[model samples]
Target: MGYRFHPRSRTIKMDDWIFSPVLQRTYASTEAHYLLLRHLFEGQPIAYCRVSATCNSLNVKARQYHEQMGYKYEGTFRKDNIARWGTPRDSACSSMLDDEWPLNKSVLLTYLLATNFDADGKQIRSLQELRTLQTRCSL
Candidate 1:
């Protein structure tokens, strides 16, 4: 079984493949996450979502993904209750609303354009890059 999201979840475990291999180089994970957010809530308000990375397992690469996707690191969790891969990153998250994206179309578009999967989150070149890698960013 996979993980589920809830309002009470302080830190949510993102998909594994998201940070593995090319997904990290591209926003496949981020887009997937956004699409997940867009579809999961089905027209609901999201204040934030906590994301964590396994220590040594990921570092700047994972952090970069969250940043471009609009997640801010809150802090780290040394130990909560269970043992984890590493210290989990404390991330504060936010996303665009379906309707609000319309009002902020231009701004949102620019944000998307500026976002690059590699070194960025939104990348117009992402398709081409994915094609070269024989990978699909669409989740």
Candidate 2:
């Protein structure tokens, strides 16, 4: 994960997210990302947190992951960056505001609980599903 902070705006931009193939299907990446968000929102004076994923098939999962974590989609930034191979890349942007963090944090904590997984380490409910349920409960 990459983080850039703007003091004046009290915003943090998170990019360059990666998860090793070996750790796929495990919740390690999810836990780490949530921890980072928790720290930023709870420990720092941040008002907003933005995350971006390169818009491509290879990043579909990454985009979904961010959405599952309750980041609201902003939009795509077309040709905003050049790839390592020099190709123009579009990026999908999303963000979570300070007021929105509490709900997301609750959902994350509930999903990360040991009881949420079984002996086989499979989640009883997905993060997205839990988020939906939590949202409904709040309403």
Candidate 3:
């Protein structure tokens, strides 16, 4: 998911991803997030980027996923918008800065390019797993 923010802002918004249940756990959205950030940072002067999710258990997972991708929690806006049933929903915001891109890009590439998946396509090392290993090695 990629967005073209207004010229006044140097930020890009990461949009949502939807896929069939069978395609879940494939890390497709993770790959797309990496590709979008890479393209934006490499092609233009993007100093910041953000992704938002609704206040729900699923969105909490989404937030965690964004964090694993190197975004920092920026704070949430309670009752940000009304949902389908007219219930107010909160928005969880997370962001990444230009200076933080290199490490994230390298980490994501390592996961995407790894050949450790088993016959059923389950990953041998999850993103968080690889990130921990990367952090340990860096230290």
Q: Per-prediction TM-score, please?
A: 0.41, 0.88, 0.78
- Tell me the whole-model lDDT of each prediction, alpha carbons only: 0.41, 0.77, 0.67
User: How do the residues 16-118 of candidate 1 rate in per-residue lDDT, one tens digit apiece?
Assistant: 3234565554444545665554443343555323433222223455555544444335555443323255644333223333443222323223334544334
Per-residue lDDT value at 119 in model 1? 57
Q: Write the per-residue lDDT of candidate 2 for residues 1-139, one digit (tens) a residue.
A: 5566776766777775777898765788779878888877777454444333334424788778778878887888888767779998888888888888889999999999999999998999898889999999999
User: TM-score winner among the candidates?
Assistant: 2
Superposed model 3: Cα runs more than 4 Å off: 1-4, 45-58
Question: Which scores greater on TM-score, model 1 or model 3?
Answer: 3
Between which residue pairs do clashes occur in model 1? 115-121, 115-122, 116-120, 116-121, 116-122
RMSD of each: 10.1, 2.2, 2.9
Could you tell me the TM-score of candidate 1? Answer: 0.41
Instruction: Give me the displacement of residue 13 in model 3, in angstroms.
Output: 2.6
State in Å the error of residue 117, model 3.
1.3
Rank all candidate structures by their TM-score, best first, as comma-separated numbers.
Answer: 2, 3, 1
lDDT for 93 (candidate 2) = 83
